[model samples]
Target: MTESHPHPLFAHGTLLDPQVQAALFGRTVPTTPASLTGHTAGPLEIADGSRNLRREFGGTVEGAVLHLTERELAAADAHAGDDFARRRVLLGSGEPAWAHLDARPLRPAARIVIVGDSIAYGRCDPQGGWAAHLAAAHIASNETGHRVFNLAIPGSTLADVAAQTPPLLAPRHPDTLVVAAGINDSAELLAAPDTTRDNLSHLADRLTPLAATALRHNARMVVVGPAWLDETRLDDYEGLRFTTARALALRAALRAWCEDNHIDFIDLWEPLRDRPHLFVDGVHPTPDGHKELFRHLST
Candidate 1:
């Protein structure tokens, strides 16, 4: 293989197995001993209830560099599946090579069900929203059997989410339940500034039952707070006016409720606060915004 044409892949674990190599490539390709610095490999759960090596910071992973053709590279990607994502890294031999690293925190395959409002449903983004981006990542990687189900409605409120969840959970019974709501509820902010705290309290109250339902199903729950909004575009949504202050208040309430309930909380307010370009109409995120949301969720 010519140096410029074929690709070099660093194989630390299963890829080094002869049987696995033959099965994936139809033949064993040439390999040279290699080592990757600043990473340590450890057993991590993968899809199909199997274990795979997950790389972490602070050590070295002993492996080999396998030369592969374009076809073989594609096959290697398929073989890597959802457990890992291919990244170019400089090896100990001073050569840049592709290496498969943990795609997300190493965990067993799971069914993640997302419930919320339009943002969760992918409103302004042509590529869908954050949920769609998440689902696409899983599909593209094919690394794990993780499945994401987005059940967000355009104008859903906390009550709407609570009302719809039970029926949906009956069928999916997901391993993880993600709730991203509160933007619609913040509409009350248009009425009066004092309504901000009231809205917060109201949302906290509504979260109680919804969280109970998640606990009943024994599903790990994650609550995603509303994203930062552009006050200048609030007028675009006819009759709907919510300030960034209200959104921030709602986010704080959501965080507090999650803390009290011992559930995971993802705060979208602070992270997207300065990135106004990510929003298309103040209420919904652009495709890039959704990408950013997905990145936060993954990490």
Candidate 2:
């Protein structure tokens, strides 16, 4: 028989407030006093003056253990806001529960680290970009209460994502690792069918371990295929677009890999294929287009 873990959450913060708990998960979850070892909970005397749990050697702090369903855990994650970070931890009694601790020092919130290029970076928006909008909306909607850490270097490529993302994520261990790059690898010199296919497979191989790790922690892994390009405005000026066939082939490869590995795949190509107005410069999306992408993404 498989060793079963408890369906409980360790609350060390505002979720302990009865009114807050009732509002978020519909009812105050039942709780029992508990403690976590090797850590210290704090009001920390800082910005917002909220509590933080600082890890210390051979230390322990008291909290409460509450029974929560997966649905309730997700709701609680949403309610915690960006200030807290949730992680799997073992209680003092050796039971594992998701712990919501202050992440203000090291993180803005539970993380959704997006690895991608200019399109995802929202190149046209003088404002932060699509990633910022997406992050903000995701937080606002109370989905997972996670913030997007967009590592969308303007000129990044699929090869770059494969090379850079995993090592970065291996340490931070975000709840979601969104690979939002593909078009770059399907760029000028690398746009061959064989090359696109190989790059897709290679990228998947690189992301596999990180995805596995996230899954083991009850996290999600996502792959967003390249967006559709405006055919009429194709140009040589700071570009990352391809012919329709090349774009579709790349999308197919990416979608195939995600299906094979059971990773959540967001297909931007098909939805935006005929929507040329969404593109501001044949490549990057306008803010409106970015909004559309956000709609497709969060759902």
Clashing residue pairs in candidate 2 (N, C-alpha, C atoms within 3 angstroms): none
Best by lDDT: 1
lDDT of 2 by residue, 1-299 (tens): 11133357776666677777787778877888999775666555222222676544346778888787777776766766665656556678876666665543222224577878888777888766667877787567555444557777777877676667655665555655677787766665434425333454466665666565555533455678878887567645443335666667778888887767645677776556688888887778888888777766655
Reference-based TM-score, model 2: 0.57
Best by TM-score: 1
What candidate 2 gets wrong by more than 4 Å, as runs, is 1-110, 142-145, 170-173, 190-201, 209-218, 235-241
Model 2 superposed RMSD (Cα): 9.8
How large an RMSD does model 1 have? 15.9
After superposition, the stretches of candidate 1 with alpha carbons farther than 4 Å from their true spots are: 1-109, 140-144, 189-197
For each candidate, what is the lDDT?
Answer: 0.72, 0.66
